[model samples]
Target: MFKRIITLVILVPVAIVLILLSVANRQTVTLAFNPFEPSDPVLSQSAPLFVFLFAALMLGMIIGSLATWFNQGKHRSRARNKAQEAVKWHSEADRQKAKATELARSSTLPPPAESAPRG
Candidate 1:
């Protein structure tokens, strides 16, 4: 809940700013794939400046995420190893508990039965 509030606080203004920026820069710009041919009809696209900005932002995010994931690979591996060990330990503990319970049951003697004769 606190995270949601903080996210809203941070994202709301950023969203508004992006919206305003896109609105202000609504003019279409031609992007040519071939730098040598500025007027290349086949290799050029006309799009708003915001489209390029947003595209760059998305691309950066994707690259950063991939880099972060790769950087944390060792940590993830360690966590997975620890989790497997923990599961093994838990199963061992359960087996020991079952053995202890069985031992306790076998070690204890049964109560003596009393038979009364009625007249």
Candidate 2:
């Protein structure tokens, strides 16, 4: 519930701002890829200013996410190694426990007799 409220609080304002920005910047703008010709570009496309803004924002986010993931590669590898070590240790403990149980069952020692009550 708390998470949901926080998400709503953060997202609601951002959503409102983005909506307002898109509405305010609805004018068409041409994006030219050709640097050689300024007058007429061979590679160019026209789109709303907000569309480019959103596209750049999304691209930046994806690039950032990839960079973070790459940077944490060593940490992720360490975690995987630790998890495998834990599994190995757990299996070893189980094996030792089973061996102890088997030894106890095979023992020939008699059970202790109860002491008599004093009169």
Candidate 3:
């Protein structure tokens, strides 16, 4: 939820800016060149205004996602490693506890030589 809000907060203004810029410059822009066509079209007319704005928005989203992933990559791996280590340590401790219980049960009787001599 927070992430979504943050994304919207940052992207909305950028999208608005791009849209406004496109709208303002629409008149000055011309259709894009087309080699297939006998005559190249004006650049602005070539692509719809919405298409340009959508492309820019998508580009921004991709950059934002990549940046986020890159930034979190190390921390994610580190957390995973820590969890694995914790599991390993717990299992080792369990094994040690089992060994201790077994030792206790098996050592109830003393060695014959260590037993008190008969009166």
lDDT of each residue in 54-90, candidate 1, tens digit only: 9989999999999999999999999999999999999
Could you give me the TM-score of model 1 versus the true structure?
A: 0.83
Q: Number of clashes in every candidate structure? A: 0, 0, 8
CA RMSD per model (angstroms): 3.7, 3.5, 7.2
Model 3: number of clashes? Answer: 8
The lDDT values for all models are 0.96, 0.94, 0.79
lDDT of 3 by residue, 5-29 (tens): 9999999998888778777755433
> lDDT rank, highest first?
1, 2, 3
lDDT of 1: 0.96
lDDT of 2 by residue, 3-114 (tens): 9999999999999999999999999999887788654656887899999999999999999999999999999999999999999999999999999999989995888998
Model 1 CA deviation exceeding 4 Å by range = 109-119
Which parts of model 3 are misplaced by more than 4 Å?
Answer: 1-45, 109-119
Candidate 3 vs. true structure, TM-score? 0.52
Model 2 residue runs over 4 Å out of place are 110-119
Best by TM-score: 2
Model 3 lDDT vs. the true structure? 0.79
TM-score of each: 0.83, 0.85, 0.52
